[model samples]
Target: MFRRQFLGLGAAVLAFGLSLCGTAGADPLPDLKGRTIVAVTENAYFPLNFTDPKTGEGIGWEYDAMNEIARRLDAKVEWKTSSWDAMIQAVQAGQFDIGMDGISITDERKKQVDFSDPYMVSEQFMLVRANENRFTDAKSFAADPKLFVGAQAGTTNYFVSVSDLLGGDDKSPRLRLFETFGASVQALKVGDVDTVLMDKAGAEGNIAASPDRFKIIGNGLGHDEFGFILKKGSDLLAPVDAALAAMKADGTLKALDKKWFYDYRAAH
Candidate 1:
């Protein structure tokens, strides 16, 4: 399935999005054809969105999950990659049908864009070098702005690090921009960044690939939900929710989670 078929629905999407409003599951999904959904992601967050080490293909939980949802909707997907910061904003700006990343559904983010039902839930966590106990949790990280807690710019982790950890809720992190989470993880391994703010699930992949280099610190900063993001009012949301509902009800979501994520966990 290719994207060209969806042009008509794409145009319909542009015209009707703003007028359509309600929860995702409020109405039944419409029959859609000749529609391609342009989904955006940053292949930085492992297990969710990441470049495959073997074929260099973009592969991860989000990749597989979105493709599955698209199949059920009889829609095709064209994926665009960018820095994590721009992915959400692009969806908000109507540049894409939806954004699929390990995007946490935070209240602050909901103000900017709408989200599907949460697909995966994981605790916000920190990764620090082995034997480095000087810094542990968000509170300790906030004690010193001089310490570099690396995160992709404009992400929830970046926001959390800047406000809740380094600065205050109102402040942004001192700002160390990286092209991807892999680079930031490398920085953490070498101590270039004192810590890396990541989801517990994502950090697990990094830890599996590089043992003795990184470890989770402190209790998780608490749980966060990940979801597919779209513009505030888009026709596409209903079908996505519908597909997700089917996936959730039949245990498909759990099975897929275990396939990509080591543990089987669903975001409720």
Candidate 2:
């Protein structure tokens, strides 16, 4: 399970306001008229994009949002799966028409693929076992060299572990790299690592799924914005952005957030 604390009070306030606000309008845009799009995701990130443990069905906020986007754009989406490490390059190579698995927008990544407008903004937090009490925050965790952090390589979590959570050294041995966020969390569950860094949305989903097993520690590290990825100069970018803008303007985006982030948690 996961827990969350905002990076700052102001951010928390803004998040709350955004959640309750209705969309301003639904402007018309270029429509694909039933063109097919292949979208890929690593079915590992809980609440964003993951296979249901019981049903083995892919489901999450990203799935819901993408479905709505395809509907609005008059497109058909064929879902695909890829490892997180290979997703970017695969998208860049034109193996997939689009990709999304809570990918953060960053300059380094932008060099490889174009990103749609920001869809969601969140902050990173420390995810730890429920009974954890050794150290409360990043500083204390870093002080004890024995305390290890689990993270997936080339992710926001790994970068945060090296730069903010661990010391500014990427080679720090105290950090354990895993192939997926689920694997890192599994390591934490089995006492292989002291903590795993995850965004607030992810943490909440994990915690909701396994409330007794995990908890979040300290305030969040910093802000991050998630977006969809496409091949460089892909013509699909504009229509996709238009769909997203339309969703935001019509309150569909906020409604989805509430359905997945709040209502889904309660139901689960």
Candidate 3:
């Protein structure tokens, strides 16, 4: 969606104008009581999703969103952490009812798994070392063979970086694939990769935490939209949509946005 359209929807949502899904009128929110809804995440999209430092429990924005959805549905949540590449596959295979990582909404993805209303919208940004700024421009990365850009497998950012920046060929800068965003970022720090491309929020949060040592690169990868993942045609999509709409309408989304992404707000 265009920023204008998105902002329009945001206004309507804020003004309580979202219409209920026709199917939801009969769907009855499902009897989620005593039942478990599995949620898949990478635990690498910081603030949006991450593992607790001490307890190792999953915690973050997506985590909080799932918790809210589960409570509204009267269901218990079973969080399943997985590689970013495996998240959509797991949900498509019916291993989980929802995938809550900061997965972007795209036309290609709509074929594999259904997505509810977008919970957040933003662009992709590259993470690079503070001292080096070569990756800030596409022209530099496009010309250099020495600079390697890292992106997780099965993500739109990877595809875009390869097609748009790398010219869909192997002769240009190479894309090093990581199983997780965290791993990819670590690769950057260890000098295994020249830059790591990820969602804007994650990149911003990491940059904020270590402002003296890191920064986001490039003009940003444009209009990335995020939504919860569900098996294509799953019965649960309607209620999930409704809950997300309610969350946005009631200001819960902004509050949660502040909690997780205070320094950088996730686009709506």
Candidate 4:
């Protein structure tokens, strides 16, 4: 299974190099002039897509990448917002031309909507209080029935906690479900839950945003790749995929990763 394969890989095997540049003389993409693409996101996933607290504007890695993709494809982007729970279905129903919110590409989802080439891959980690000492890793935390974990219902983080970290009981009383990822983190902040499972990117973003309040614990639980989502059989898929390939070949993707993941971490 994909989940088992991802979890079994060591950290070294999961690590990626951002320094890799794209190859020279890659094939050019088809011109998409005069096309306008509508994109949707939750704007709640940090580092991927989030509203800037100070500026009150949507900004982050996905926003940057999507803007670049639009520029390269000669298309204008019209941004819209939706709740994470509704995003995939909304896209599948043709309510949006494209959707992105750190969405993981799974075979199940592929049946409803097509995914662009993967834009980012990340690992899951345990986010705990800064002074936490009761448990250091998943196994230790699972052994202690008193310890609670917060995760948004239906998210990969939630399933990971249920199956991979805990004992595969979906109805575990120790699991506290939230409506949003940020809400789960907030639950952890107030000591409502002992920890939360978050992707390494979001964990870093939250830790950077509140270094004195939270910290990541344990090795990464598993790895997952994120991709842009579109309605199945949408005409935009080929051009979007080509744009992503060009960005990968031209080092734009690596540059954005460094800017949002590394440089942003340092500045924040």
lDDT for each residue of candidate 3 in 1-268, tens digit (9 for 90 to 100): 0001123334454334223322343334445666788888877778787766658787777887788777767788887877776778889999988887777888888999999899998777767888886656777877887888887767776777787668886344477887777777778887888877667767777776555677766777767778888998998898788777766765768756655665223331
Model 2 TM-score on a 0 to 1 scale = 0.90
Candidate 4: which stretches are off by over 4 Å? 1-24
Best by lDDT: 2
lDDT per model vs. reference: 0.72, 0.84, 0.72, 0.82
Query: Model 2 over residues 1-268: C-alpha lDDT tens digits?
Result: 1112223443353355345333344356677978999999998887778887668778877887898788768789999999999999999999999999889899999999999999999788999999999999988998898899999999988898898877788888898899888999999999999999998878888788787999999999978899999999999999999888877865667766766676667666
The superposed Cα distance between candidate 3 and the true structure at residue 71, in angstroms, equals: 1.3
Question: Model 1, poorest ten-residue lDDT window?
Answer: 1-10
Question: Comparing 2 and 4 by lDDT, which wins?
Answer: 2
What's every prediction's RMSD, in angstroms?
Answer: 9.7, 5.9, 6.9, 7.4
Clashes of each: 7, 4, 0, 1
Candidate 3 lands at a TM-score of 0.81
lDDT of 1 by residue, 1-268 (tens): 0101123433343224323333365444455785899988877777777776658888777887788788767789999887776777788999988997787888888898999998888776888887787777777777766777787666767766666665554344455767777787888888788887788777776776676777888777656788999999988988898888867765567655555555312210
Candidate ranking under lDDT, highest first, comes to: 2, 4, 3, 1
State candidate 4's TM-score: 0.90
Residue 157, candidate 2: Cα error in Å is 0.5
